[model samples]
Target: MERDPPLVLDIDGTLTRPEGWGIDPRLFDPLLEWEAPVVIATGKAFPYPVALCHFAGIPELVVAENGGAVYTGDDVFFTADRDAAEAVAREYEAAGYSLGWGPEDTVNRWRETEIAVQHDQPVEPLREIADGYGLEVVDTGYAYHVKDPAPNKGDGVRTIAEHTNLDLEEAVAVGDSENDVSTFEVVGRSFAVGNADDAARGAADEVLEDVHADATLGVIERVRSA
Candidate 1:
């Protein structure tokens, strides 16, 4: 018998608009009814994704902080050097960057394995500073994520597949920004929503015409056919 691969989704421009403030209500039932494991992977902090999953009434696992960590219900799999991240954050602050933490926690406590900062501030200089410490900086929508690049969204999805006993090659990944590029590289079926950034669209196997949740639904329909 053929088994269904997990559905890995990216939030922000993929699930909701910058103005929507939440996952599209239209997706709730489809998500709750899906048989395969559903995973919400985002550059957002742990608490927000955790709360969103809870509200959606789905058993989807969450890979937060651009794959710097994985959260399954209350259990967490964090894999970053906090000491290194803190040092870098301090350096950026010293260089005159005003940083804002993610929605639920302070910059220092946003994620166990990564530092999340508001993207409205400068990041190129921060990236230069981060490189000296062997860390990579990624811009995920409205936030900048500083973490070990090895464990990215792709790795997060891979971990979820292993945890759920699904085949990596059968999985579907959808997103709309540079941060999702890593995920596009690793998933079998990779899609970039119409609103995706240029880099994200370039990295995807297919770019959907519809935007946001509509694009996500398009991916699901295509996957259902595959």
Candidate 2:
């Protein structure tokens, strides 16, 4: 049998159920049984994807913090400076926003290379402040990430492909938000779920009718059949 192409996937809106934070139970077996590498690429903090990989019984290949961090099982790579992101967050806080998750925010506690501000917070102010520090603000739909402009999800995908000795031209990516646009651009084939934002739909090679984890499963089946 031919080997399946490597896959890069986003977490929240792409793999998890739309109604809640839980990972759709259907994804576990497919991930474990997948023939090629499965890379979890998300704007989430580093530890979150790492832990997910552990429990899912998959290899620990991850692109977390919106490409700010990459883990290839043996080594970890950081693309940006966390202090700069922290500075941006501090300035946003001084401007009278509460980081949107409250005083003891766990959302960004384990984050290493960037700060994730809650989506409910005003984005313009965060963007304005990030400009002064040479950082960029990206809305992942789940949150606004303040971080370095140099690295993105595409860069992380390239790094993973190189480390795994896989061909970029054969990789497949699936996602549902703006943060996913970079990965869509870098991979050979990309799918945007039905709930995907405009940016992701524009960047993807194909837009699926299914939403969330269901769409992801559909993509897997399509690839497997091909």
- Pick the TM-score winner: 2
TM-score of each: 0.87, 0.96
Prediction 1 global C-alpha lDDT: 0.79
**Global lDDT of each model?**
0.79, 0.90
Model 2 poorest ten-residue lDDT run:
16-25
lDDT of 2 by residue, 1-226 (tens): 6779989999999999867467998999988998888999999999999999999999999999999999987789999879988998888888888688877788899998999998888999899999999988988888999989888998998898878865778889999998899998888999999999999999999999999999999999889724
Q: List residue ranges in candidate 1 displaced over 4 A.
A: 1-5, 18-21, 72-75, 101-108
Clashing pairs in 2: none
The TM-score that candidate 2 achieves is 0.96
lDDT of 2 at 62: 96
